[model samples]
Target: MRIALGVSYLGTAYQGWQSQPGGKTVQDRLERALATFADVPTIATLCAGRTDAGVHGLNQVVHFDAPVERAMNSWVRGTNRYLPDDIAVQWALPVPATFHARNSARSRRYAYVLLESPVRPSVETGRVGWVFRPLALEPMQRAAHHLLGEHDFTSFRAAQCQALSPVKHLHRIDIGRRGPYWRFDFEANAFLHHMIRNIMGCLIAVGQGLRPPDWVAAVRDARNREIAAPTFAPDGLYFLGPVYDADLGLPRHTPAFDWLPL
Candidate 1:
C-alpha cells in the first residue's frame, strides 16, 4: 500500500532534507524510524522539495510504500515514537499508487526573513533570520518586482546547481514590512539552487542603498554571478509548503499560512 505523510521539522539540527553519508539528515532519521517500526528492510520515501542545511520547513510532504496494513494513526504515532523531537509526523493517509511527492507538486512557496535591530534576536527567532542594519522596506519591495516573471536566474543561481537550465517562471514575488523587519514571499513552479536567498541578498543591498533599484534588472540581463549580491544565510529560509492537486488525495490547504506574518 502507498501512504502519504505530512511532516514538520526544525532544520537547525540536521544537515539537510536529503540523506548524506556520515552526516545527520532528516531523511536518515525518518528512514531508520520507519524501518524499525514497519520491520521492512527497504522503504523508499519521496519529499516535495529539498531544503538546504539550516533551512526549515513547516509543511513538508513525503510518500512511501509499504506492505503493512496499519491504520493512518498508527503510522503517525509509530514514526514519532522513534523520531527525534525536532522532526514530527503531523498526519498520514493512504494514497493512490500513482501519487508522487515531488513530480505531482504544482507549486512551492518560500519566505525569507530579515530582522532590523542593533541587538541580536532572542533565542526563539535566532535561527530564523539575520539581524542586520535597518533596511528600507519600500525600496526592497520595488526591487523584488523585477523578479516576478519568467526569466533566466543565472545570476541568482549557485555555481554548484545541477539544474539543466537556469530558466524558470516566478509566479509571484512580494515584499512586506512589519515593524522594523522585512518579509519576502515567493511562489514558483520550481526554484534553482540558492535562488531565493541570493535574490533576498541582492534586495537587501538595494534596501541598504548599496545598490540601486535597477541593479536587479542589470544583473539579470548580465547573467553573471560575480555582478550579483551574495547569497543570504540559510537560517532565514523556510520551505513554506508545496501545492498539490486535491484529486491526488493530498491535503487541500498547506500549513504555510499558519506561520505567515500577520
Candidate 2:
C-alpha cells in the first residue's frame, strides 16, 4: 500500500527536504526514522516540493510504498519516535494507488512571515525574515496584482533551477500586516527555485519605496533574473503544503496550522 504522511519540520538545522550525500536533510532524517520504525534497511520517500535550507514545512506531504504492513497510527507515532524534536509526522493515511504526493496535488501553498521593525528579530531570529525598514502595504499590493496569472517568471527564478518552463500560474497572493509583522500568503499551480523568495525581495523593495509598484511588472516582462531584486532570506518561507480533492480523503492541515495566520 502507498502510505502518505503529513510532515512538519523546522529547517533551520537541516539542509532542506531532499536527501543529500551528507545525510543532513529532512528527507534523510525522515527516511532513517521510517526505516527504523518499519524494521527495513531503507525506505525511500518523495516530497511535494523541495525547500531551501532554513525554510520550514508546516504540512509537507510525502508518500512511500513499504514492503511491510503497519497500522496508520503506528506509522505516525513510531516514526516520530525516531525523528528529531524539530521534525515530526503529523498524520498518516493509506492513499489510493493513483494518489501521488506531488503529481496529485492540485495546488501548492506557501507563506512568508516577516518582521518589520527597527530592531532585528530576537526571539524569532531564524523563524521569521527580518527587515529593519518600514514597509508600505499599498505598493506591495499593487506590485502583487501584476503577478496574478500565467507568465514567464524567469526574472525571479534561480539560475540553478531545472524546471522545463519558466512560465507558471500564480493563482493568488495575499499580503497582510498585523502590528510589526507582515505575512504574505501565496497559492499557485507550482513555483520554481527561489521563485517566492525572489518575489518577496521585489515586493519588499517596492514596499520600501526603493522601486515603484510597476517595477514588478517591468521585471516580469523583462524575463531576466538579474533585473529583479536579490532572493529574499529563506528563514521566513514555509511550505503550507499541497491541496487535494475531497475524494482523496487527505487532511489539509496539521496542529501547527493554528499557530500561524489563517
Give the alpha-carbon lDDT of every model.
0.83, 0.94
Write candidate 1's Cα lDDT for 108-187 as tens digits. Answer: 98887767788777864735576567788778777878888889999999999988999988999877778866678889
User: Quick one: best TM-score, which candidate?
Assistant: 2
* C-alpha positional error of residue 132 in candidate 2 after TM-score superposition, expressed in Å: 0.8
Instruction: Show model 2 residue runs off by greater than 4 Å.
Output: none
TM-score result, candidate 2: 0.99
Minimum summed lDDT over a 10-residue window in model 1 is located at 252-261
TM-score of each: 0.94, 0.99
Q: Report residue 231 deviation for candidate 1 (angstroms).
A: 0.9
lDDT of 2 by residue, 1-262 (tens): 9999999999999988889999999999999999999998999998898899999999999999977999999999999999999999999999987778999999999999999988888889788999999999999999999999999999999999999999899999999988888999999999999999999999999999999999999999999999999999999899999999988888888888788754
Candidate 2: deviation at residue 122, Å? Answer: 1.3
- By lDDT, the best candidate is 2
Cα error, candidate 2, residue 258 (Å):
1.3
